[model samples]
Target chain A: MFLFMKQHEFVPQVPYGTRDFLPREASQKRAVEGALAQLFANWGYDEVVTPTIEYLETMTVGVGNDLDQHMFKFFDKNNRILALRPDMTTPMARVAATRFKGSPSPMKLFYITNVFRYEQAQAGRQCEFYQAGVEIMGASEPAADAEVIALAVESMLKSGLQKFQIGLGQVDFINGIMEQSELSLVQRQQIKHAMVTRDLVGLGEILVKSGLSQSDQTLLKHIPLLHGREDMLKQAYSMVTNDKSRRALDNLANIYHLLENYGVSQYVDFDLGIIRDFEYYTGMVFEGYTPGLGFPICGGGRYDTMLNSFGMNCGATGFALGIERVLLALERQGIDGTQNCKGIYIGWNKENLVKAIKQADTLRDSGCSVELAVIPESCAQAKESQKSKGYEKLVYVE
Target chain B: MTSSDMDYLTIALPKGKLFAPSAEMLAKVGCTAEDLSENSRKLVITNEKEKLHFIITKTADLPTYIEYGAADIGIIGKDVLLEEEKDLYELLDLRFGLCRMMVAVPEALKREKLSDYAHMRVATKYPRIAESYFHSMGIQMEFIKLNGSIELAPMVGLAEIIVDLVETGRTLKANNLLEVATIQPVTARFIANRVSFKLKFDRINRITEELRTLLEGVVTL
Candidate 1:
């Protein structure tokens, strides 16, 4: 036996940046997905599934060349390039444009699936992660953006997260402010890079070197810091002179008012410098951050141009919550939970095992969780099994 | 966490050169510590009576700490912030620890124009910044990522030129390199977590105002 073990050694290992979930963790993850799926249904979103593989070029069309290298891609049997999707939004947009033509004006779809990326793994982050999100297509009003946010807030609250806030902003507004600047293309890119990276020092040097007036420099400098109440919008309103800036501010103000009407205002805050995914995102973009988590647990925004790239002209907005990040928040708050089942175990002696099986079927048919166990050799073993298996009740039959 | 941990406003400061000036600025806002640099082994420096705490971390990790809300505030350099690209509020430019990100070459290869090196081989820590800069100019280059001893890359023939931070030009001069172009100027900046800024508005605003006034005073002096 020792010689056989030495000759044919079995090594168990998964790929780096991937994870294997034990029983308890898998159950908890399912619970989180179930809750999100139910909420998506409640909000009039039907479930949809896209193929896990797609043509690499189609998936990489707007996902940026920087992110292209991170996607997991392989060659198909037909010598065609196929890549595992790094996100659901692009595939969903492709489907909405091609498959569902002439069916409905607005299509609401939700997915709970795994997306893979080639990134260094960290706590609450993985190369392969699960996402629960919805896509609302053909709606361009502030109402659509607010509804997406309302659903996100509701989903987070339902998942037992207490301390989380969403930073709301319009990408166009930042673009509008930059358009007002007379800085050359190179200088403007430098300044925008600084602001997006939250580098005040770099931003200031470029603004000063541009030789702008004190007020314009101040406005551009403070754009990243201008986040808060109605007054922040008022402050931004007083600064710009361009029409796009004016319209962007008005759109933001309208979205804010609409979110207030959605009754999720407490979970919403405004920021003028939310530049994440801004190039792909046209109007409203937001990020969800919970206390004590360095990365955003949820992020999405309005992408009017994405579907157009897929041969459709529909406006859409949606957000995806990271399943593992939500679970981390839950675990941090000590909220590891199962599917909330109360089961009764029916135990019987060997002579009456058939009777116990009948009883178990009766209980299960009547909407009760039932676990059946043949009588153990000792009472202690029977009781121990019942306790460990979370049986609410144990019935001993002769 | 202890009761003190719950109530105190936390600030994360970079551990090396930036800590002294950041601690000095925080001191002006009535947040001080007796042992900021006294013990290198310790991570957290605090003044419980003032409800202020500071976490010492690598410059690269400062944005992560602040973004995750582990610390309510952070003071870091523009280079680290740009490299990290975390979501946070840039409250003010504290304006110390200034330096320049420069594209440099060996002094022997100095007089040629940038276009002369059509196939530029560059080595530095800031690959993302360099990639974007070169991509904008339609220039082709090979990039190498190095953590330290970037000055050795050019001498060893690994890269023809290097993009690195130049503080006093002493290191560049010693390494037989000359600065060709400046990418951007960098300085220390005060930053806040976006969520914390809203939840702890009054204290954050008060501290920011105090630091701004103090910094203005320093400039005039």
Candidate 2:
């Protein structure tokens, strides 16, 4: 029985939490990537590439412990710990600090790359995912952050995303206020975890356990509650008393107004509770979302200190959009992405085989997508099954 | 709030302790989940006048529905929210279903402080929360995942301590257990699908604002 079961068992699957994209799906994914690439290029972001596998320390350097745990790691023949790049931002930072040293100020670099993470598989999350992103180095102005965000909004709209938003927040505000408190490291971590998880009740309990002043606790609770239109900024303004916290609010407000100048303020909103990926972002942070999707399709922020950790004293900010997630968002909007390009199918009988080749060549020379397939003495088979798979125009060589 | 338009707002709710109070609040602000509650088997209750729909599901499933876009809005307890950790917007704290997630042990083991039980066995339905809780206490604990009857673990010595939800001391007292630590307070939160909050901003904002207004008097607590 054991031998029979072993013989019948189907082995060598695609492995759990991974995926393979069919041609149509791959084209759709490329379309999203191309749209984002064109926008990044138009905004002066030069495309860049990094190794898919790097030394484990290089990939994990300056990353939060959470990111490290998700990374897929292995050892090289040289006994060096190597890992698949879990994210492009840190690798980009490493490159900008080393390879592009003194290249210029504010180097605008972009990439479309796939990353690997050993994460639990679920809806909209695959172990091997693609990210298209841009990183700006040596830029410190609010406009730089504003530029990346504005481009993100434009790219989403340009890609046919009808409804979406970019939630903007500053890491220094909440962390700054907590830094002033006498709460222990564990207490602060617990509270920050609660904030990022949107757990107000848990945050309240932690604040109480830390024995903060009653007014401080109230202020802490009220800060995360700040959301909605610009008026919510007023509540945030009233709550921030520390100089650093107040300055962070001012930076956020400035970015808000800058996005307004860019005419994309409607796509931008503020959230004080956003502190995810805090190990990387030092100041302004933003996350992109559309209706019906739970996870953010895109997330990035300012990481002025990250490059410095890599031995370069430069300021930087950037954003990355997951290719698969953008497709899902488009699907939610009933945008299947097959509407734009349809292939021309050429069916050849024995009588017109040479003519079919010439006709296919003619169509290809005319900048049309052509799919050639031999018919079984009839064109009926190609005609019926082609429409659903995006073959709009058909040519009968016979 | 009902319109002839095709787009309508869908809300998912957990079908237990928080349901009645949540339904009461929803009724005040243009939705009535009680209509579907009249028939125990009906999962969906609709209000044509308001164009609002409610899907009643297990409390643990509310986040999955919101995450997968089956439901645009949900009202669930903070415990489940923390346990599931789905990516939805916590728009408002409904300020209802007030309870505490506590670390409890049998009264017979109350001789030492919590730190004394380092590397001990702890049981809970929320292993992530329990792990973090014990981690903060500088204790190394083995977590045993139990879906229900968490109190029985400590009573029968399956685990030295249990972390479970408690609204009243009656159950713990009947089982001869003493509450040793409080992790977090539990309350019903109004969560909106991240995408729904954008496309349906006007409607989602109105509902969240109305609910927030409802909690103005009791928010200080």
Candidate 3:
């Protein structure tokens, strides 16, 4: 026999920070997304799909230019730049502002889609990832915020995550503190940046330099540490004297009571320092965390000002759950999220092909998953195929 | 996993100088583990009764462990945190292992300012910190990454300047290098994984409160 070898063996590789989900993972992801989509629909939210790419300026209007570096941008035919949507909320906001502006007062929209960001690849995170999220526009009350927070907890449960907590924070809490302080605008930004990054050392350094009173400095430094149950909220209320800060506390307390009505109060903690990275978040913010993952698996907040950029001038609140993160959390917690059902495999002798096909169709029509073999095989061979393919049962026709 | 195993609090400790003091501090909070010495070959030590696990890791890898939630908490140098840029809660300053990250030059070159040598070759183990510092100062320089013996780079013509941590000026003095600029103060800091900080809040808060009281006592004394 002549040896026939190719000159070069091809090796397949995915692009940096991207991945291909093989069968098992793909099925699990699909199952989770389906569950979330169904749940969102059940909650009275309509599904809205947007284009994968949009004008760079449109994305900047929602997320700001800080995230411009992370976006995947390219030139269009007219030399205008277009970017892969870094987040679905911005695109969802765009759709709401332009398409659904005059339709109604409150438009509840949900999306299950991939968002692109150039980030350092890690477990439970990637450059191109999937997010299942919902946005409620035009409702500015604490109820809207509470509904999204409660829905976020429900989304985690729907994804089969049992142990997780939602850290609820109001940006206005800190904003109120900064408003009352005599520090300059630059100082406020620096302090907020430190708090957002959870850099307590940097925060202390800035507070020391800020000319606020000793008690004010102590109160500002204590904002991040003010996290716990309802009692912590009561304690925080006593710590700040500013009306804005007190109002923020009241907002959190109001949202907490609503969460109790939703029966998700046990899952939330008052994290007064949770100024999310997104500058668009102008109101209450929250992040969902499970034990196994280092990062927040889901996060969102109220951004009442984002729609004004699109000229709609509506208030909005929403949350997004990282699909991969939910799956990873499920795996780590030893919970199987994928319901793989291998119903039956049908095989046949040379003349039994038609019969086998009929049997498969019958089983399928009866709501059982069935796979029919293409070529003829012995009963033993058919059994082997059935066993190897993980089918629960086999039907042999001779 | 046993119910007790589920409650086990894992802590990542850096190897070398900070190891002893870190373990001692943990002991004060009643989280003592066997085989936790720096000289021990075991990477992991456990206190089964107390439900605590201590992982001995390289100084740079400490944050990686905590950030991935492999370890719920860690004690690491601020310099490494600055370089690694991992997302973690800087819980408390441990107030020990103090040092300063300094940009140094060979005495013979006699450069007083970083801008004086605009296009010079700078060597460092911390490329990220050095690059950002240089960029902030609008100075462009080639970088030579060295693992150890950073002072030797400037002495042997490998690089004109070096950026490294200085606990004392003794090493630079022996190597005939002069400190040019101080980047920032370095200290061992207590850090926690973001998820663990919430999930194990009560346990972590107890230890943090204890340590805070201890540190406050030290400060007042």
Candidate 4:
């Protein structure tokens, strides 16, 4: 007998930033994605697909230096460098520019895809995760922008989210501040770094060192403190005398008015300070959040010039919801995205083994989830001739 | 969902201009917070009848608190809401503490024809908001992140433009900077932690509804 010499048996382990979803988790994810897909479709956003891998250059540019460093880069068989998409937006942008160039304007595209980013895994953040979102191309109107925010709210509500908030801000507002400041790039970065880390003393000292006048220092010191609701807009509006600052305020006012008209003002709030992850968004940007999660559930903004890099410039605003984060939120809230599951658990017996198998099939065919006993007769008999497997409504046939 | 068991509704109050006013509002709502205003100490105060507890935190941390369920409700500026982008139900407008986030550039760079610097170096505390604005204008620029002293980035030639929150243009005028754009106007709000809103619906809703009525009166003035 030829005993085929054994090959090396190695312990199984998943690659870092990857996971194997068990049955329960997998089923739950599928159910959540299905509900999200239905919601997206209801908004007339058709699903689209993009490659998970792309040439390094196409995905690298405009992805930002910080993100560029994190991309999982490797070489193909031909030795050409490639990267797993760190975000869906870049891939979607490529698709829009190259493939759907002539298709139409205002293309409402939705996608359920995995994006890879190398970061330390924490509470709601995974190195590799799924995102379900829509990118509305070819429009920059406040109404269209408002539509994205509204759809996000509705999608979350459909995902069984009862309590959440959306923070809206205008990118131009900060740009107006920068346009009026004399701070250097490095100084500006240091200041932002301090503010993001909540270093009030550091922020105060930086303003003083920037050589800003006493009045400028006072005003700059208050930047970290500005935030909250509508009337704050008026306070913010009062600060800017120049037409540029006034225009940015006006843009925010218009958006607020539009959101009010959409009947979503209740769920919406304003934050003039929210600088997002992307380096590309220009006009209005926003993020959605829930209390249970440590990070934003979704985020996007008006990347008007993102397409310009692809040689097509059009005003656009959109947001993306992290499916995994949303799922985690739903779980925390105890709202099952899907509740349908099998109730039948089959018991084993030496004489009834065939019958159990046939019965399991029958139950499954009838749209019931059934678990068949896999143990042999000895173990099965020792436990019980038949066991209900903890089902509240257990059935056994002799 | 009945949530009568969760009695004390925790609140995150951003400490600043909105801090005092929000504390007063909480007092008016019967939520005591004397310890919050005390200096040189970390204190968390709770009011039994009001069924509210207050956590004094950074303006930016208010949303984080609400977002993380650490605080059932929070008081924050509209500007922080715009920047941090947390998901909380803005239950009411506190009608105080207002500001503006703006785009500015050195006076010399201001007239250089924004299009001329295709690759403009921009500095701002609000990078996401700044990037979105320039993106809409079809302008591409490198973002230099600064927490404070955004004005310095322009003066030192690190970036030509700046984006920071502005309450008054006196600073810009003093710095010889010009405003190019305004991202959004700001304010303070009564934001609800999502789960708290759901679990303590009746209590939180009652308090917010009352505060809403009071603010409606203020807004008219």
Candidate 1, residues A1-398, lDDT tens digits: the string is 35546555786668888998886788889888988899999999999999988899988875767668888989999999999898988888888988998768789999999998888687777889899999899999888888899899998988878778888888888788778767778887787787766656568778888887888888887776667877888888888888887788888788888888888888887877777743578888888877656567798899998888887888989889999999887876666566555578777766787877888888889998888885542456667777888888887766
Task: For residues B94-154, write the lDDT of model 1, one tens digit per residue.
Answer: 8899998888999988856776765768999988887777777778899999998999999
Scored against the true structure, residue A16 in model 4 reaches a CA lDDT of 76
**TM-score, cand. 1 vs. native:** 0.82
Give me the candidate number with maximum TM-score.
3
Q: DockQ: which candidate is best?
A: 3
- Model 4, which residues run further than 4 Å from truth? A1-11, A193-200, A346-366, A370-398, B1-221
Q: How many Å off is the CA of A267 in candidate 2?
A: 2.1
Q: Which sections of candidate 2 miss by over 4 Å?
A: A1-12, A179-187, A228-235, A374-376, A379-390, B1-9, B28-30, B38-42, B48-51, B88-221
Question: What does candidate 2's lDDT look like per residue over A42-81, in tens digits?
Answer: 8888999889998888876767677888888989999999
Where does candidate 2 clash, by residue pair? A290-B195, A291-B195, A291-B196
Candidate 3: tens digits of C-alpha lDDT, residues B59-98: 9998988888889888999999999999988988889999
Model 3 chain A: which ten-residue window has the lowest total lDDT? A1-10
The lDDT per prediction is 0.81, 0.81, 0.90, 0.74
Give the per-residue lDDT of model 4 (tens digit) for B1-221.
Answer: 11112556787777667777887887776776545673427557666656666678877677877766777777788777767766556655576777788878877776655667568788888777778878888989899888788888888888888888888899999999998767777777777665455445567767876886787777798
Error of 3 at B214 (Å): 1.7
**TM-score for each predicted model, relative to the true structure:** 0.82, 0.83, 0.96, 0.63
The superposed Cα distance between candidate 3 and the true structure at residue A368, in angstroms, equals 1.4
Range of the 10 consecutive residues with the lowest summed lDDT in candidate 4 chain B: B1-10
What TM value does chain A in model 1 reach? 0.91
lDDT of 3 by residue, A40-86 (tens): 99999999999999999999998987799999999999999999999
Q: What is the DockQ score of candidate 2, to 2 decimals?
A: 0.31
Give residue A29's lDDT in candidate 2 (0 to 100): 83
Relative to the unseen true structure, what is the C-alpha lDDT of residue A40 in candidate 3, on a scale of 0 to 100? 96
